[model samples]
Structure formats: C-alpha cells, structure tokens
Target: MFDHIQIKVKDLKSSKRFYTAALAPLGFTVQYEGGGAVGFGPKGAPALWLGEGDSRGSVHIAFAAKDRAAVKAFHAAAVPAGGKDNGAPGLRPDYHANYYAAFVKDPDGNNVEAVCHKEQ
Candidate 1:
C-alpha cells in the first residue's frame, strides 16, 4: 500500500549499525545511502529510510512478518544489536486473536515493530 518511509537519526553510522542488525532477521538490507541518510528494504527499492538529525522523534514503523516466529526472531536479533525491548513476542488480543508481534526502540528512539496476523 505504501512506497517508502524516512526517519531522522542523531547519527547515521550508529543508526546504520542498529538497523542493519535489527532488520536482518526480516530479510531487509541497506539498499542505498548518501551523506545524511541510509535506506533499507528489498533489493532495488528502499522502503525504510533513516536520516541524520538532532533529537530524533518517536516514530512507529511496522514490518509484515511471514509468521509469528519471524516476529520473535526480529526481537531477538534487534535487542543484542542496540535495540531496546518495548514488547515481547505474543498474541495481542486487543488488536485481534492472532496479532502476534514484537516491539523495540532503535538507537534513535524510533518505535520499530514486527507483526504477524496469522493463526498459531
């Protein structure tokens, strides 16, 4: 439904390190980069973008997961690579019966999430 997203970070290199490790579990990689920004997504197209800035705002970005396990893996990989846990992997009954997801705050305090809407 959407084409891409851009986020501002305090430091490009540090944000790159955090995102590189965090998004790896979801099969996304850095697709392009310039002086003040880095982009990540599937090959040839950059979906999520990070830019250098001061006082990075709290942003919410969610990735679609193939299944619940992928969400778990995302959280697992993110935390060890400088991501702070916001939530764990589990069903979010408030959203739906099978809204399995995980949440983390990246180096720049943007709220990143991975969710799977499949029965488990």
Candidate 2:
C-alpha cells in the first residue's frame, strides 16, 4: 500500500481550485496547505499531494468510491470544476464485472478516476 502520492502542477492556485471541487463528492477535502503545497484526503490523512511546479508527465490516479453513486457524483462534480470527461460512469466488464467508475482529465491532463469495485 502507498502512504501518499504527490504531483507537480504549473499553477498551485488553479490546481487547488480544481481538486477542491473535483474530490468533494468522493469525501476528500483539503487536509493541509503550507509550503506552497496542498494535501487532500480524509479528515486527517493526506493521500494525494499537489505542489507548484512543472509536471514532467501525466499520471493516472484512481480514487476509491464508497459505491456506484459516489463514483457518479465524482464524475458530475469533476467536470464543471475544470476536468475533461475521459470515461463516463459505467461498468467495465473487462476490468471486472463490478468495475463501475468514471474518468476525467485534470487541469494538468492527468487521468483522475473514481471507482467502485462493488456491484450496485
């Protein structure tokens, strides 16, 4: 298991705004903000970290949703917050029978996903 993951962005403020809106539905919030970096996750944990700088390359980060509805909510919330739709919410039988999820490209063009591994 990973303790945390960090990504670099061109603009901290803009990326912060995007993530603030995008991750809300999945129950993640800004956990810490200091040293020109922002941390997001549950109340006290920071699973994802964003720092201001040039992003060398894109990365895919999938967040676990409690259920299918939460996955849908994450997609709905992410789009208007500056995310581009990559994959609509649905089952990926290839990945698995119950791989219900959605994907969006973040401001930095990173693949962000919200997935529920359980059948609804």
Which number leads on TM-score? 2
Q: Please name the candidate that would achieve the greatest lDDT relative to the true structure.
A: 2
Give the count of colliding residue pairs in each prediction: 0, 0
- Score every model by TM-score: 0.94, 0.97
Q: Model-by-model lDDT, in order?
A: 0.89, 0.94
| Model 1 / residue 15 / CA error / Å | 1.0
lDDT of 2 by residue, 1-120 (tens): 899999999888988988999899899999999999999999999999999998999999999999999988889988998889999999999999999999999999999999999979
Q: Which parts of model 2 are misplaced by more than 4 Å? A: none
For each candidate in turn, give its C-alpha RMSD to the true structure in angstroms: 1.1, 0.7
